[model samples]
Target: MFKLTTAAAEQVMRAAKEGGTEGMSLRLAATQKEDGAIDYRMGFDAATEEDIRFQSEGVDIVMSPEDVPLLDETVMDFVEIEPGKPHFIFLNPKDPTYQPPADA
Candidate 1:
């Protein structure tokens, strides 16, 4: 299953409230590229019958069945990779470009 770090959850919650999507799930999708890298997309959306739904860090999330395998064991995080700027990052081990966090 996919998970979100505390910072990511907080950011998502804040964005949901600001975007008037507070009750919607955070929709996630991942597709593997030819070279085994994963591409990710996300937005607030309503869950459909075929969607996989779960809660992580108090935030609701939805993903299609097709994305399950690609996102399995993935973790989303919000961090300041560069000074004064924060970004959302997917730390997916399944991606060939993935490297374990140095701090871990």
Candidate 2:
């Protein structure tokens, strides 16, 4: 299953409220690039019958069946990579360039 960090969930919830997408599930999509990198896209959306639905950190999430394998066991996080910019990032072991976070 996929995981969503608390920070990520907070950001998503905030965005949904601000964007008027409340009550909708967050849709996540993953595609493998030719070079073996995994690309991720996400937004608030209405889940279809065939979509895989789950909840993490009180956030409703949806993903297509075909995207499950690539996203399985992935952890999504929102962090400050630079001084003032924080954004979402996917920690997917299936991605070739992915590196596990070191123990704190």
lDDT (tens digit, per residue) of candidate 1 on 37-78: 899999999999999999999999999999999999999999
lDDT of 1 at 34: 88
Which runs in model 1 stand beyond 4 Å of their true positions? none
Error of model 1, residue 18, in angstroms: 1.0
Q: What is the lDDT of residue 45 in candidate 2?
A: 94
Residue 13, candidate 1: alpha-carbon lDDT: 99
lDDT of each: 0.95, 0.97
TM-scores for every predicted model: 0.96, 0.97
Indicate which candidate wins on TM-score. Answer: 2
Residue 77, model 2: lDDT of 98
